[model samples]
Target chain A: MSLSESTSRRRKKRANGVEFTAKEFKRQWILIAIAAVYVIYGIIFYYLPLAGWIMAFQNYKYKTGITGSKFVGLAKFQFLFSDAKFLQVIRNTFCMGALNLIFSTVMAIVFAILLNEIKNIWGKKIVQTISYLPHFLSWIVVCGLVHDALSSTGIINELLVKFGIIDSPFQFFASKPWFWPLVVLTNLWKETGWNAIIYLAAITSIDPALYESASIDGAGRFQKMWYVTLPSIRPTIMILLLMNIGNVLNAGFELQYILGNGVIQSVSRTIDIYVLDWAINGRNMDFSLGTAAGIFKTLVALILIVAGNTIAKKTGDERLF
Target chain B: MSINTMKPKKKKMATEDLIFTIFNTTIMVLFTIVTLYPILNTLAISFNEGSDAVRGGIHLLPRVFSLKSYKTVIKTEGIITGAKITVLRTVIGTLSSLIANALLSFILSRKRFLFKSGLSLFWIITMYANGGLIPTMVLFRSLNLIGTFWVYVIPGMVSAFNVMVMRTYMAGIPDSLEESAQLEGAGYMTVFLKIISPLCKPVYATIALFVAVYHWNSWFDAMLYNRTNTKYTTLQYELQKLLASVTAQGQGGGGGAASQTDATVATVIPITIRSAATILTMAPIIALYPFLQRYFVTGLTIGGVKE
Candidate 1:
């Protein structure tokens, strides 16, 4: 039979309340085949890894493999709690993550509001374009730029010295006290513009009639922005904040890894970096211990996401799930 | 308009709005300067004479201009190999990922596809719950993907986020278009390739640019899997290695015996070369930005607000 004849026959069968005909299966076979590929890919790459998390409980060794490794139960978890450095790493991760979330979110919102208020389209476009360019550059490049700018004799110090703000050049990267602030500032500089794009989009979707009504009520520019614009985009803000809460432990490994030095090691080593150090670069290469840390981070993130989603759902805001 | 004309009250509002505009413009200008200055400063240092750059007064322009740093960086063997590998992977990776993601998204977007929900759920679950770093690395190692170029191309062949965005975009396309093509007895592949694919150029370009940028900028995978294999090292990874060396040398109290060979070049700063390398690493992405700007912005707004 021709393809159309078979399709028509299948349609007739379907109309007659019959199901699972060979012709029906043949018609949808292409889609099924495509989906099968994705399903296999997901199983191998995604689901297999979840199973591999079993290594966290075992004394995993490359020679013996995960299945052959002796089961050590909660020994690795015990080690994590006993290790002071690991505890410090966790603290560093949370502190840096919280600071990053607060500063980046606030700056993005403020930048979006300011950009929205600009009447000159060309100026707004130019500023927005320039601001977001840094986002395209990798952390390696951003760290390189930050390093150069904060170097002892770099432009920052030159200006400070010339203005007599400081008597001499200060080593910004070397100081432990300056590490967290620098991380926060770098996060702000790299992400504020890109993050603001969502807020800007949200602002554009706000009803223009609301602004007009506010104008008729003798509302000034700031007053209209405060009453009409901010409230309108509050849902977007809440949703983004909730999502960011899930990532609070993922303070990131790259920027800290690149910019960190022995001087600021205490402040710079995040949980991901801690995992890399133990799993890949440790003296004995403790795979099981590293896997336990990895499992911990993932579980916390999952819990946070679930909690955030539940809260958002309850409050009738936006839920990621 | 009549009320404003009768009261002549528009002047106060105009003045207040003007002040607001002035404040906004000033803040934006300052921000632009801050963002642009670092890049321009690095550019200036790259061009300046190494000795002059070390003396530290170069701001916006080169003091004693020379291409020595650029020449040195271009001549490095690792950089050349790294660039070749980076470009090769980016082209291969972007093309494969775009095709894979496009196919998956197209399948999902079709209303006739029976298991769309099941397939989407399979991918979306991975987005929220991952095996994390160690297990994923172990899986890659076990597959023998650690030392091969395919490692980069294969693992990222299909991203759930890109699939979601493309699927949403494809769903927005009217079903009548696909039905018309199907009425002419076109198969699914023909309907997708000849009809729907052409119509999705904007979203395709958007996702393609994103995938390309990701492949270009990726270094973490190289640092992990390709650590032992220098042949597969990417440009970004090479730059990172160079950065580590520079930092190490700085901490070790400058070039120990290396500066003795060229006494005249002793004053030449290592940072000048590093800055030039940094510029070389970023130059391609910066160059591609202007052309890809419109598509990316459209993609962001669509993916951001709609999703």
Candidate 2:
């Protein structure tokens, strides 16, 4: 059939309630072709890795590869659990991640609220702009700046010594106890402003009439902020909080890897660094063990996400999925 | 007496509001200073005489003004090569990913596309679950992409998040426009290239900036897959190595026989060079940020609201 005739026939078929027709197929052929390319790309880069997860169950050797490796039945996972260093790494990850989450979230919200209260448009714009500047910087650059500012001879230590906060300049990087807080601070410095942007948007969407009503009810500035603004953006806050919960284990590796030294390694090592230390850099590279640790991390993240979503659903709030 | 008291109370409330505004503005100004001081300090250190920078009190301005560090950094072979590679990858990576993602989004946004749900589901599943780092590394190695430049470009050619954002943007473009073009016998490619591409400029710019910045900042992948190859090192990775070397030298001064020499060397020039390298690394992004900031904000709002 000619194209036009077939299309007309398809229209007749549609009138008879046929959902799809050959004419529609022909028309969508180009789109289908384009989508196929994405499907192939997705399969290779994404789905292929999922299939590669099977290596976690095997004694994965480089020479033998995943397909040729022997099925080990969770021996690698057992090894990860038995390792004391790994446990320490997990503890460090949780501590750093939790601190980061709490600090960044609270700071972002507070910053957003404070920013929204600014009556001067120029001041608000300038502050918001400057705040997000750090977010654009690479962690490599941020860590370099951090090291410069916190080094023994750096301004921060110099100021502390001059102010008599300390008798002498201290090596911030060398102190194990300072690692978690430093990580949190660095994360806050880089991310708080960027994160605040979302909250700021959320605040903007709030009804002006609500604020007007609050004012008519004789609410003060603080009272309106507390009762009207906060409650209005609460759903946004809850959704973001739930999403962050799912990332509790992803403390990240770059900052710790860059800033960590021999003296502070105990506090600085995260799950990612631990895996890299064993799987890629150790005396005997254990691929299966590393894969198993990764698998464990992914499973925990999945559980956290599902649990978070469940909680959000139960609370009648926004759910990520 | 009650009416007179109400007037005073209203005046008091106005003063209270004024105080709050002033208080809020002060905090913001302080916050801005805190955010800006570090960058300015880094810049100052970079411009300071190498020897003078080590004395360590250069707060807001260069103490002994000199361009020695910048000259040295610019002349360094490692940094120049690393920068060239970084720029090359960022351009290629961003362009390829943007095109690929745009295509996927266009396909998915079409109401008549049969496999939209399945395609979206395939990408979404990957977002939440992954095979983890080791397997991905092994896969890359097996594919012989470890030392190749394609490793950077190919693996990130399509970001699901960008695809979704673009899809959302595309969905907003009136379907009647495309229908009219189709009625005139314009093919899908013509419709996309002529109609949709021009219309989706805002989202395109947003995604492009994001992909470009990501490529520019990425170091971990270069550190991992390109470990054996110095030629593949990016600017961030090179700077990381330079910083590590400086720290290593500083730490070694504590116990090594060459402690005195190392200390002198550290005090002489390493800090300034490190600062200069850092400033150089951040210069491009910081320069371009103001112009690109609005698009990012718009993108964020669109993505956040849709979700």
Candidate 3:
């Protein structure tokens, strides 16, 4: 009789799928609720503010809220597309990104392979420590160091003249062609050591037997490296390559911001800097275009990430899913 | 096979290894000179008397060393205020980020968290699609966080890669530990904090270092949000402005120690003061790295191991 009566009063799953009788469901919901607050932390601070993308379509003003800002639809993009300066910014961004990717990866991989070959552990540790220090430096210090070395009377120029490489001191930063290489090399110097950290991990994971077999087959160090080491770390290389492709649009902001000058601004301006200049300095207060540029960067980055991941998947079993 | 792993070779003289060591040392010495010289030059300049910095040909050492530039730079009330803000922001920001990352990653690590896939998709979508900076700035202003230090820390608290790293590390942590804790009547929070968190100590340290350093180094947020409010400028921003002002003044051929206040009066500036300001700005991080380097590699690997 009690069971029959209870059957009439039985709990059912809620429409939102919280089973009334299930403690696991209740606990899950409770945890989800607590986590929802943090999800908002990501949303309110990191994600939702992206709604500011609408401003790219509007003529934004400090006086007007985003809702009140005048919508200009495609005008900002049209202007940007037509602007020669913006075009230059695009070219510079891509060129720098491509060069940086090539040089940083190659050098880092080579450095990692070389470091892995070090028979003495202490020497390797010292080299790693020395290399990683530069990455900790803020660009402000880097820029100053850069300025010191590149100045007309700086050590670089002095050395160049003394070595009979040049007749007189050449202004490194002042020259356009030199600026790009300088930026690239400066980045390489700061990042190669730190960047090689992952490759070192990949190399360490390589089975010792493979190297032994290569030696048994009479392979020298170079042959063992090419046949054994590189293949073992191939997946790491692929994944890192794919991940970096997503960052191609980011190019860099700090280096350009610091090294940029009137003479070299044309080739040095990145999309981030361009958007920044317009958003902060220009009178148009036309935030929509700036927002559009941001959106463009995000979109391009996303496409590259997905595309790279797909290509990686097709080529190798591993990809950033 | 065990001996085969060693190629069963004779102990050949390591002459080549010695040569390679010398080569490596030479490479590293050049690297050290390249890396440390400019930084050291800046340090020397920061220490140099403000008067001699403008002649500007300093290399490994300062020709006329003095601590006047440091005194002048450090004496400014703004630097103290900025440093306070930066340290506060770094600490609080790191705490918030660690919390957020841990929570997000924990949820994602659990297979039974029904919305794990949905939430990852949601977060990843946000990574690819965003309104952009101005809109975000507008939102900050509307929220009245524009001039607040929150502007510096909030937007960057939880990054995609950091979250992913945290998730991967959490996933790799043996799940049986959690099951055992549960069997002993430990709740999820207890399991997470008392047990799992400790297991991820190396990663915790690395993330702390990373987020802390990031907050310490960032000037963009301050540049954007506190541009006019020098009262809330971060140390890095203040340092940058000092450099910019010096460079602008140095344009004049007038030989001299330039006064910071009279930034416009002189076209020429001391090289040492600029270098000194740079050194002053970066000293904290330089000092911090050596102590943390022992943990760095292990921490870096845990946090950065690619999926």
Candidate 4:
């Protein structure tokens, strides 16, 4: 149905209700109409821009809109595959995603495990506060902070110099070898605390009696922790891991966008950044290529989510569904 | 205030607990240091004299600290206008969002509500599906909302996640409260407004903060459609321009347009100026975080567990 027809139907629905009058429908509809507006907004803004997807099918012209543009059809897609940068971005997205997932989960689990071992309430709370703080920082801020620290004359280089680790300051940002690792490590540092929170909550929920029973059986501290705490939070870990698998394509847009200067340009350009640069950043909006990129992202995200959900269903665990 | 101090008698600590305490203290201190470093560095750079920051002189602390960057920011044209616009958007956006979320969530929370499953599934589908940006832009243009204030506020006024959270919280509320209110001949609106909304103070506050923060932090809508429309640019978007454009200018790609636009002396405090803008943008959000952190662990923890 068109937007107006839907509004009329909404008016009908309002009229039939007990307290609803035709006038209240306008007010309630103005309020309840937000849903319709949301749907309409999604249709108008999100979906309709997709019609420009044809730009991918054509040698798009800025003077003429998508309709007036020449029809090329699958040529852009073919050109994309032929482009060597496509392979690098795909590889970069996956490799970075994998590292981020592995590092974040492992660090979170470790932090949660160690936190569980802590008896001092105030101390544990402090750790929680401090660790979670980075999660709140915008990538803009985080990148600025990183620039300050990792620049040649920054604290890290100074410390390295004072300790005589290097003859001269090195440009870490320029080093290809350090690019991916730095991205992963900084991500781990920012996310581990926030990510660990869910696990910590899960860890706390695990029955204490299990640990007490293990202790009664003469289980040592290590043995009890291994046999109890780790096992208890396993399901939570799996769920998050599975969820991460679905989000593997989202190797972060902001961080890559900011940190990716000309030095690490080849390795750092993920799919999202590619879309922003080619589609949004440049002089002419390449709606077709941009839509194609968005479609690829959407399709990959959908497939991964369904695949993960299916796996989750088979395992008989909690799923986003 | 001293009531607990004088009455406390069991001050003894367990031996195992003592070791654990030390271990935990060390962990907390280490993590705290990690968390504080970046923020402290940013703040320090923001406060540092412009030239010192450009030369990479500041570290964990400022060197010959100065308020020049902030002075430039405050004196810049349209800053108060930007701040006023941001504050207004946050308030109106939160109000409309809260209303829509509360109404929808309340309806969906009831099993007896008409078309509950279907309507909810519609929202759930929205999480996964989109028609792309071109169509959306066309639709908004057709609707005449492109250059209007409604463009920002209407499109994103309600979030599915907030709706789900509020619904979960509403489900937890006893039906007896509503039943008794109905017995007093109150309508659904009255019952909801009088009883449920008040009872949901914590949840409301949490969601309000979430929506408010989202509005305050968002520069995307403005970036997408507001570049030419000087009146519609939010504070975050304007600050983003101040931050990003300066860098673009310094790279000689844009010829120092941004720093020159400020009408202040073109000082070479590039990093310091960027840091200053960052701090100003994040200040209110960071301040609000600690206050509402209780909700993250308490009321909002409902859907986190599977079983």
Best by lDDT: 1
> Which structure among the candidates has the greatest TM-score?
2
Off by over 4 Å in 3: A1-22, B1-25, B246-269
Residue A28 alpha-carbon offset, candidate 4, angstroms: 12
Residue A218 shift from truth in candidate 4, angstroms: 2.6
Q: Per-residue CA lDDT of candidate 2, range A120-212, in tens?
A: 788789889889889889998998888888987887898899999999888787677888889999998889899999899889889999999
**Candidate 3 positional error at A271, Å:** 0.9
Q: What is the lDDT of residue A221 in candidate 4?
A: 67
Question: Judged by DockQ, which candidate is best?
Answer: 2
Model 2 alpha-carbon miss at residue B60, Å:
1.5
**Per-model lDDT:** 0.83, 0.82, 0.73, 0.69
> How many collisions per candidate?
0, 0, 15, 15
Worst 10 residues of 1 chain A by lDDT: A1-10
Q: Give fnat (model 1).
A: 0.53
lDDT of 1 by residue, B48-152 (tens): 888778888888999899999999999988789889999999999999999999999999888666565567777877777889888999999899999999999
Tens digits of lDDT, candidate 2, B31-143? 88878888999999999998777788899899899999999999988789889999999999999989998988898777777665567677767767878888899889878
User: What residue pairs are clashing in model 2?
Assistant: none
lDDT of 3 at A276: 79
TM-score of 2: 0.94
Query: Which has the better lDDT: candidate 2, or candidate 4?
Result: 2
